[model samples]
Target: MTPPTGRPLPFPSGASPLPIPSPPALPPHPPLPPGAGGPGARGPGGAGSTGPAPGWRGLPARLARRLNRVPLRARLAALTAAAVALAVAACAVAAWFIVRDQLNERLDESLATYDISPRQLQNQLTACSGGVEVPSPPSPVTVQIVTAEGDSCVGANMIPVRVTDSDLTVAAEGPRAELGPYTPEPGEFRQGTSADGTETMRVLVRPLGGGGALLIAQSTASMEAALDNLVRLLALAAGAGAGVAAVLGLLVARGALAPVHRLTGAIEYLTRTGDLRTRVPVEGDDEVARLSRSFNAMTTALDASRARERDLVADAGHELRTPLTSLRANVDLLLRSERTGRTLPTEQRVRLLDQVKEQLVEMSTLVGDLLELSRPEGERHSTPVKVVPLHSTVEQAVRRARLRGSGITIDTDLGHWYVRSDPAMLERAVLNLLDNAVKFSPPGGRVEVRLRHGELTVRDHGIGIDPADAPHVFERFWRSPSARGLPGSGLGLSIVAQVVRDAGGTVALAPADDGGGGTVATVRLPGWATGGDADAATATGATGVSGAPGLPRATGVPGVLGVPGVPGGERDRRVPDGPVTPIRAVTPARPPQPARRPGPADGRGEGTGDGAAEEPPRS
Candidate 1:
């Protein structure tokens, strides 16, 4: 799953010809995808054998993964929205609780805030004790009290409750709820209830020191109406606050991410122009500025790589001219001779024909190398890399080099070793190294091959390259001034470096620091294996790595090669870093290459990998 990338780049070693490192191993996966294990069924760690260990189990990571699949802009917006909504909701709930408590507490406080005495209440009670009960409004807050004389009640209007003999008896023992200044005394008060059911009686009762009692009542219709209004106002405020907060939050989010919006527009502009040089005009040096800087850096790097690519092509064209010129001349000579009825001696004609064949062969070799150089990037050959024998492959490569070179003695101190790689690719890489050793070695000087573990070092005792030239040695078509007279296409080491990478190995070139100076190229590989099985890769080379190294260890079964050369149709026989992200391209397919300079990244691109730019585990 592709997640939002944070735009941090890991450094790739520059100029040193360092090989790509192998990736870390992955832990085992979980048993049955979630829910595949039935309810109550334990995971492998929990006693079921079908899952990963318990300590490693958790939901947050999985949730992150799930969320990562979401578009970053949308994901961030959702997170912000959810946070704001929860905050506002919590505030609303708290406010509701606070308001409710206040209303209830205020009502209770009013009931406790009275100063009327029991004696005054008794006098008032006595004034009406033997008379018939007066009618009153229903109590907004229920009011009733027990006095020494008997139990009595008042309604909202400071009148009496519906005191039927039975109701009076029942209410004498019960007050529905307490409210107001429940003074025991008959304070300045009024009893009233409008016909429409408003209740306005505030009543309080107190017992005298042992036997006496008093009751008082007042009308509270106005206060009840005021409190009711207050409650409605509070409700309105709560609703308004919540609505305002939600709206404000959304606006705030939009404002905060304004830079991102601007960046988006700039990116669109760049895409339309197909120019990475276009950049967002940065504001303050914030994360957005950092992002802009990173983008610029990336583009600059890409530009440099592009520049290098152009140089490679130009250099290749220049080197190609010679073989092509020779081939054309020979062909013309043969054709012209055929047209002219010149009865040249049979031996002379045979010689001319042989010359044509030799020139054609040379042209073919040059063309092959050119083709290796021309293979495009994003080719779909994501192949698995494995251990390849160093000794044998180099030996075969040494013999191959002999076929192409003259008067070169091959020397070696070697042992069987294997590296993670494709055999065809690894073999080509070694061959390129051998070719370079032969080309630069003094006509009769020895070219030494040393293999230890998975490292192969080739050294020649000839015109050693300059330190300055060493930097550009593996660059396509690069050559040294000291070696101007030497016959070379300047692509051998480039192919060497390219294929080494595909095989998940590193290649380095340096002038022999030893008193006997010459150029030394070293290739280091991973997935080193020991023993007889490695013969398939390295034993074929000269002064071969031979000894009793053990048996080959098994890696997984390799898949079949699809289209071996084309990137789009090429199967996973090249890149070992899993499947390529995009399986297709906008293409004029890879251009045809002249077939001669055959060292590999295909030729390892491990392209140009498993001959040009491919890597070991990464290819």
Candidate 2:
């Protein structure tokens, strides 16, 4: 029962309303009348749509979606087949219509050629009842005569046509007057169905200059037959063509999509095995080849990444083993002594404990350094970089080095320089350089530190690095043969190089100036603005460097290093006899160039951060 005027009545609990059947789906739009809608209602696009929709319209969309779900090979084949079928169908339809029209036109022209003189027609009619000479129009043509009184008579053919008003009018007007108003011109042609209505006929009524008109007609039977044959031939050819097209389309699609198949297989294999080394073969410069190349490049990158990760793991294990083994051995000894109910000497126990502590610290430092080096620049220092003060960073580094190198004397002549760099990374890089210098210096030997403009130089009075073994300083886990016994890892300079490169700078190692015995490390950073003239500041700054034999004054401004009194790059041409600052150009996995006598400073020569001359590595 209804509960309220506007509210529905409630049913019993657990009862449901009757289900309503859905109506059948309808077309997107209703059948439109000709000229009933807008401009879209007619023309080539609207030809088929002018009538009610076909039954297959709804099914085609669903069928098309299903077709699209098929494999790419099948889809390509189908598309090619459809295109060819369409072309063949269009040409067939066009040819059929053209031939039909041409045949009908020839039939009409044939009808026009039939003519009979007015005198000959009258004579033939006069002799018609006597079975005398009757004017024969043509064999397949049927003729009729209309008298002045609208009477009809058969002329030379078996079939006779009903005389319409137009014929009667032509008769009354005497063969010379206009045939009828319906005719376009005098003696113009007309087409009508034959008496039996089985075939088309071309009709022409001409004025005979007498009291009647002559009607000439021809049967279109032959033309119709010819048209029928043409239609059948066109349909057969179209069908055969479409079939061949389907086969060819499949073949072409297969050949064209071969590369795609290979790529798909490669991707599937990669997915199944998690192997990044799988690559699609590339063979040509086509689009498919380009895609293959891109896939190859991606796999190559992934493989390289995996290799680096493996190497890092292996190297890390190797590095940690020494410290871990020592720590374990010492702890085991302590445990052994306790278990035996015997105590080691106090001094020895303290030393053993100290060694363990040192190992722990070293391990901890190594792990920290590894973490720092492992991350990308963004993750290593998440904060955005701003202009940093290089002078202060150097000062801080020097202080840290002082604590590490107690027996070593440190000298500094830092100039005010500003650069765009991560402050923490810059400071760390400087500290690494300082540490390297102090570690290599002889006892009581002086380590000169100088910062002029954006160039920072750290020189140590130790055995100079051999020219032949100089290039591997920046490779991860690489150590110099002479430095392997030292109590440090080889990652310090590598870290320095990574930081400097991130900050858009360069770092180099060379021998002390003028053959001074020791190694010198130099760093060059960009974006520097200072109050002092760059050239003047660098020239005066030379005072900070100990045992620096005076080279000819370089022609460039201060802070620019080259031979003295020589043009830029030309100093490499003339060789000096004395030992000069070792210059090195460091690149990844490449050997360093040894410093030789200063010659022309041609840019082509391998120049290092130090004012040293050398040749580039052979390719």
Tens digits of lDDT, candidate 1, 527-619: 334544344433433111111122122232121121224557532242232221211111122232222222221111111111211111111
Query: Tens-digit lDDT track for model 2 on 1-619?
Result: 1111111111112222211111122236778676765755564355336644567467878997988789887777777777877898898888878887776666656655655454554444444433355445446776665555554555444455545567657766743543233232434567655554556776677665455566667766777777788778877877787778778888988899999999999999999998998989898899999999999999999998898788778877887898999999999999999999799999999999998888887787677667767887456444355556788888987887788779999999998876545677677778777777776666788999987656788887766665655566776666655455555666677778877766555677766555576777778664334534333534453221112222112223223322322456232122232222323336323234344332232111111121001111111
Candidate 2: where are CA atoms >4 Å away? Answer: 1-61, 123-138, 146-151, 161-187, 207-213, 384-387, 406-411, 420-422, 438-448, 459-490, 501-522, 527-619
User: In angstroms, what RMSD does candidate 2 have relative to the true structure?
Assistant: 19.5
* Candidate 1 lowest-lDDT run of ten: 601-610
lDDT value, residue 261 of candidate 1: 79
